[model samples]
Target: MHTEHDWISTPITADILRGALDLEHTAHGVLPHRLPAWARAQSTDGQLAMAEAQPSGVRLAFRTRATAVELDALPTKRVYVGAPPRPEGLYDLLVDGRPAGQASVSGGNTLTIDMTTGSAEHRPGPAGTLRFTELPDGAKDIEIWLPHNETTELVALRTDAPIEPVPDRGRKVWLHHGSSISHGSDAASPTTTWPALAASLGGVELINLGLAGSALLDPFTARTLRDTPADLISVKMGINVVNADLMRLRAFGPAVHGFLDTIREGHPTAPLLVVSPVLCPIHEDTPGPSAPDFSALGEGRLGFVAMGEPEETASGKLTLGVIRDELARIVKQRVAEDPNLYYLDGRDLYGEDDSAELPLPDQIHPDAATHRRMGERFAELAFTADGAFAGRGA
Candidate 1:
């Protein structure tokens, strides 16, 4: 019931792309990387490498009048062993910077991951095509935002009309760094991530450094943040450190200071907002190194529980409660010396009241609805007049 048009296959090259800092040509196609090649070389582990290449903010952007389009991609979708099935990785299409349509390709491949065993299995599959038909006539910019959580390889781009690079519109750049939540945890798609959504609402170009399981106040990450150009910047702190129980109180404060110091080294006056972690009742009072809820595992449900007792905090263990207090203190102390520095409590984005109505489904990551709430609240706080980062002119 479909008729074929004369498809123009465009070269899948980096010159026609944005958001991705580097692209690796694979045997089958090209893999987009959010981090640069030099930074990727400094990856300490496979986890960091995977997270860096996940392309949380990467998109294929161009201007065209194509009525129909086809994109071939090979995506590695993750399936947690013994856990509930995850949604398929979604590909979102945008025309003239407006949402147009979305699609998911099945049979492309799958990655079965066993968290308990720390192992994974990859089963190869063929590249799947995403087709978009009946686009409105006339020239308009189109952006295809890849799935944030899945690793995708670009194979080919086909459109009914020729496409060209999108012209710059002189939008302010907003660079952000955070953990999984900011990295698109439980987000419906890549373009809907809190940072991405907030960027759209604020009309800023996003340079997201949201590394899952790896936003541990790393010196290199801070250096990357310092080097990236931006009109506004934010760093959502505390969640990953608390969940991983990576550092104790003694080391946490100094590490934060050093991280901010590194960023200030390059962007001394850029409007920088420091955000604390959103509420996670499990870790609110209890110190963490959160562990899996085994009871839920039988039902193929994945959830976490705070393993460390609150009493352990006296020994310098960090809890979400403790981290919030510490972050507030650090920001308050530093704001006097750095006038452009500002702090926005994470609870303001997702407070106790909101959590009561829209609880975190995994006892950690918020659901898609909550992601929308957080993004909306952030835009109000950071972009509106008289808000923390509102005074600066781009």
Candidate 2:
């Protein structure tokens, strides 16, 4: 309702967005989701909804003649009730596929979550402005990667010149599903996530389905992969299944088969790479249902501890080592009949040797440097000449 810099407002619409598979128009603004609205409706769990709307790997990509651009958005920032304060979300801008600038919006909404009690409270805040000025002109492609951990609502866009969606450059699309590591947890920036880095290195469009505290090999998730048009597909399994203590060795095999079956229903021969979990020291020999370690809570630090003992494995408990072995065995057996199907040991990306230098900060997720390393490894292993994802036509 006010005037600033002779701003010409551009309505936020679906035409100018990428990475997001769907756009949901709300009364407040347009919310982008990795999963479509239909798929989201199936899960009433509030956690999954929040994760889907967090905009991990989601970006607004367009070509504009403008020298400056300002995006007005309402970001729903989460706060752990007793944990250390999280840094403000970072929005990275790229012009002509190169780094342009970085920004962060202040005074948006806050969702306070008390994990111990399983309670959440939401408080309204204000819409904040993020501006990028002085760009190299002459109709260049611009991408604004949203905060990977925050749920951002696209309110309005203001530009000095006209803008339009960037035409597809015909990059193969890679659809990936995994745990929080793939969700960019503990990552320095949105574009720095392993999948994002690998997508860039491999020259593929990324649709990241890596949901934090999720990716439990659900049929709905498999269906989403089946429906999405991806030239290459990878399902990083194990961690969530073990961490949640959702299934045992007896059920794990059939569930994996079912999940792959559902995805193959549509993508019968797409290079479906099955990735096992990376090395988690705590979860390697022990199982979970991980618990919070509150010893440092007074210092505002929250840590995790494995809840399952070594002896539990005898009763068919799941652990990182066990999951990795099972994933390899299952994939080896299946690949005999389905040559297009493949497997990648997640430890190849990060193992005990790599961990000695770049340890998981929280004993779970990889640090930014480790993420970069993992991305590079994935590009070499999966996307190179004659790799598992070599002959792609999904």
TM-score of each: 0.95, 0.96
Look at candidate 2 and give me any clashing residue pairs.
Answer: none
Listed per model in order, the count of residue pairs whose N, CA or C atoms clash below 3 Å is 0, 0
Choose the strongest candidate by TM-score: 2
**Alpha-carbon shift of residue 59 in model 1 (angstroms):** 1.1
User: Candidate 2 residues 26-98, lDDT tens each?
Assistant: 8778999988878887888786888888899999898888888999899988899789889899999999888
Q: How accurate locally, in lDDT, is each candidate?
A: 0.87, 0.88
Candidate 1 regions off by >4 Å? Answer: 1-3, 391-394
